[model samples]
Target: MTEGVEQLYFHRARGLTVTGSAATAIAARDGRVLAAAAEVGAGRLVVVGGGELSALPFLGRADNARFLLNTLSWLLTGQYAPAGSELAKAVTHERCFTVRSFHPEEDLAKVEGSHVVDARPYRSLLERIGGGILPDPYQEQAAFLLEAELRFDEMPRVIREAVTTFRHRSNDYEGLLVRGLPVDAELPGTPADPARRLDKSTWLSELWLAGFASALGFPLAYHQEKHGLLFQNVAPTPHNAANLSSESSAILLDFHTETAFHPHMPDFLMLHCLRSDHDGIAKTIMASVRMALPHVSLADRCELFLPQFRTGVDYSFGSANGVQGNGPTLPVLYGNPYDPYMTFDLDLMVGETPHAQQALEALRSAVNKVQRWVRLEPGDLLIVNNRRAVHARSEFSARFDGRDRWLQRVCLVSDPVPSAADRRGSGRVVETVFAV
Candidate 1:
């Protein structure tokens, strides 16, 4: 093993030198010397060379590869090691159902008694808008007038109540299926059938605007043209159908934090399940690094803080997305002293330092420790704290039976951010997924 290591090191060194690049190489007798050859940038490129690479045993080679990569990463990014900082001492979990449900009767009473327009009606109004029906023109105008007179403060109160109730228990994900929001009783705006059109103005007036804004405050941010809501449909395309039928098994998607490439990433992501897997096999997996932190070693934590890592894009979005490549290594955790943030992607991140490799392994182990699997059903909504957790999905078959899995995903950036201005300036709502 020793002989092979020596030979391999020499071979890599020679490769670097032969390419006329200045690099660090260890001689058999002289030990280690840093040599400078400039091609791409200023620095001694370290090269480990040898045909003995093939002879190196699996474990040894793995270590060597990790070490070399981490080193290179550090050289390129000029960042420090990971600190494995602890973020929240304890996260609060609240279930949505436990919160005060939006009640129209109660709200109506308040408005009648106090001369205020009840916002609860707005929830029903949104349902009508989303249902794609035209409401009575006069009723719609009146509903809008009522909504305009209603106090905006009440809207936030309702949203806060809902959010406070739905924060997850122990885990980082939270969920709530908001029901009873009035849907438009009316059918399509233009219809051959008149019966489809019903009185939907009230539903649209109260529910739609409130729901959209509420989503912005708690889990969804209204980041115009930058990042906000995402709409996806399970169309009957051959590719989608093929994905449904062939990938039904629990296929492991490498763990990743969403949109690491983007400058502004979502703090939370909500996926509303409109349909479930036909075979009931697909499960979404989430791993909290905070939960995994205790398992990491102190030394590994230091390495992780080092700026020797690079993140490639994830695969959901194709390659032509114009994302930054081979950027500097960012620490896995950072933020307030008490509440640290996280950035990680096992598949897209490359560590180029020995310490960074150690940190990566430690983080990997920690993530595995707290991994949670959730299988979603129709109407089941999952809200993930994107900054605090990494998530992936287990592949499931989609039988092409029109009953294939379907989900509605929306990304949100929470409080203390510039949301209203961003949304007003840009019409872009959906967050872009990076390609790996």
Candidate 2:
């Protein structure tokens, strides 16, 4: 295992060098020498093999897998074995929801018979638009009209009815399945088919956007400005294919609040499963600060409120120069005093004071306490209140088969925040990674 780890490390290091960074060897007290790696100005060193990797040898296929993982974790997390290293201090979080068979017959029938819009006309309009028949102005107008129709004064009541039964009380999250939309929904015909599969005009697509924004108290304008609906067919694309079969065993998606690095992060992030990996093992993991706060020490929680922390811009979108700076570090817990908002990313967040470090550790522990696991199946939608939760995905084997997992993602920004002009430059789509 160690030998395999060493080879993989060297291979990744070579790739990093090509991208303008290099990895060097650091001599340590024991025979184990650390590998010092840096890209641009960011630097990290890996301890090679330790606790988490100890079990790798018994698995037998690789010698260096553990070492490589430890090194990568150090780079991505800025700490080795963050959760595993401090088990006692690890906060206990929970997955308060479960996947039950969503009875399409019962659920769909209920929605169709409810006050929800029939959605047939909307689907027809979308199919026309997606087939490249609708012009840009017409498409935009259609979206506006659809939104207006769905926004009757009593619309909220209907939305409440749609999801009331599925609301999970243990956590501040809920979901519902509204299937049976016209299957031929597609995008408008434009000379430039940016999202080739279909334009954002499909009836089900618009319904999702409308329903999600309504649930979060965000207006359609806010949804269009601060968030975007993205659809990706991961089947044949080289990048996506690689993402499925990538050798990280686990893709180390460091824990992060969706868009926390931005001044206007989405209040909610919704992912609806359209397909599932054949083995059904791709688990989305989430840890809530709300659930973990009780486990933190009083002193640490207080210290964590200081404004001495900073998060890196590694995952943010901005100009080359703008991307170099760090995000403002206020307390991870702030606002309503009793029920504070949380901002965290273990890899990017940095504490400048000893108190901050202690507080961060305590917060980290609290976060680990309520670890929740969600496995998405077709027609399942996971709605995370980004302001209240941090999420990650457990790595799953992606064999590049047609059955690889696929999801449609949508984000929503709630009320009170100003519109796009108040937050971003013109001609951009809500702080997307490429918008800046």
Candidate 3:
């Protein structure tokens, strides 16, 4: 059972009987057993009084999802039982955790399924936000963001529903691509460098990104990256063409979880493409841990949960200027064992031991085996759950001209209170010092 989870909203609950000697009353309501767990002959059993506990509406009310996930982990491995109990003591003392890592080969076929939202019908409604005039995205003004949040409900039901689904079901897919979103009628030329700021005449694309991010979570920024600009420009630049950053085009951008080493890393990283590459082949590659885990060996999966890996900060965050220190040693995978979260970067993360290195390589191989490529076109917005997937880009030719591939990036966090100490007066920017 999850601690501090005293209130749970359920549609209808029934009474449960704990008849076995090994049974434990994990939960109760008005002295009536609402949930129970028992150790059978060679297996474990968990029973809930309500079938709607896993339903979406019920999950939104309290820590139902966490409770269910904890219950699942307990039943699968016999760990995370009621603290201070005999089962909990034995589980903790032994540390004999088991992972159900075996999965059918056909599961890969189902994991590649796409969740696309056709935004063609919502163009008119999107254009009305900000009184049809969008303010400068870099300006530290809260009015536009508040307006975007208020107007998010006015969007088409399909768009709103997609956002809600993406928010709730964090393990369903790695990314979501919304197509046919409104863009500027007369778009400005693509900036030639990351530092070059374009004078945008219209804010259709910006508004769409902000509105969608606001609806999902609080849009965030980093003082160390892009000077705390809420909206960052992702385009090929001559200086960064040969580097390992987002501005590079000549070199393949290695797979990475956005800000993987930082404590307050964004939960969702969104990219809205205003212009595509000249050849239209610069694919955005993504591989989810959910799909890749089944391909990994059980031993390697267990090793991935060990604290034998360290990650370095990205160069874009001033890593070259003595800020290139590696983060604290951490496990590559954590959370629910069956469906876990990951933090990985092919270039920045390194292993501390020989077996750990092998485990990391195994993870790389599994991710490559199930990687998917997406070619983003104009009016396409891609939202990725940073914790569940690692993303990269295929190498492409970049002229560094005004028409090169251009995309606007935004970061989001599910909740902002965790970074309250890093932010200034309800601002969206999180300080880098605190993040380190």
List candidate 1 stretches off by more than 4 Å.
1-162, 165-229, 234-250, 320-328, 415-424, 429-436
> Candidate 3, residues 1-436: lDDT per residue as tens digits?
5553555655578988788679888778888888888888899988889877665324433456457666877778776534423333233222323334323332222333345777777666656643465556656357777666767778888888887887888544578878877777788778865654577777777787888998778898998777787888899888888888888888888788998888899999999999999999898888888878766655566678888898888888766522433666789999875578999888778889887888888889878877776788899998999999999999999886689999999999998989889899888889857344
TM-score of each: 0.50, 0.53, 0.73
Extract clashing residue pairs from model 3: none
Q: Give me the overall lDDT of model 2.
A: 0.46
Which scores better on lDDT, 1 or 3?
A: 3
Worst 10 residues of 3 by lDDT: 89-98
Candidate of highest lDDT: 3
lDDT of 3 at 322: 22
Q: How many backbone clashes can be found in candidate 3?
A: 0
Residue-wise C-alpha lDDT for candidate 2, range 85-152, written one tens digit per residue:
23312221211122232222312223333212233435444344334332232246445434534542
Deviating ranges (above 4 Å) for candidate 2: 1-159, 162-206, 219-250, 314-325, 422-428, 431-436
On TM-score, the candidate that comes out on top is 3
Off by over 4 Å in 3: 1-114, 128-131, 321-325, 434-436
